[model samples]
Target: MFYISCTYKIMATFLYKCRDVGYDCGFEFSAHSRDDLMPRIRIHSRYAHNIYEMTDEMKKKVEEAIKQID
Candidate 1:
């Protein structure tokens, strides 16, 4: 598991309640590696609180988004 601290300079968007790697608090990712892909994201599990469980729709979006990668 990776831990990422977010700031405006590095964090362009904050998706609340996102579900993929595990649960959801605020989806924090780094575009530095996935800049070439659609809504490129690198998930982080550094949330201060427990991530809310993922819903079916949210899970699908996350899985789809992740599958687009190498």
Candidate 2:
């Protein structure tokens, strides 16, 4: 007889430096995934930069700058 157990570990931590994309807001965002960080950034941008909406290209830029952190 043989017994087997299956388990998986998910690493859910990433670091997104605001300055990476050439923004000097002095803000850094960390989240389980990039999908989670975007909204926070958008809100921050709204209050900090007074930008109500982000362009598609800007969003792409942000996605590109995200780096996983352990």
The best candidate by lDDT is 2
Local accuracy of candidate 1 as per-residue lDDT tens digits, 1-70:
9999977554343332344545544554433233432243322322343335546775456645553222
TM-score to true structure, per model: 0.28, 0.76
The global Cα lDDT (0 to 1) of model 2 is 0.84
TM-score of 2: 0.76
lDDT tens string, model 2, 1-70? 9999989898779888778878886898899988898888888878987879888888887888889977
Give the alpha-carbon lDDT of every model.
0.43, 0.84
The CA lDDT at 28 in model 2 is 89
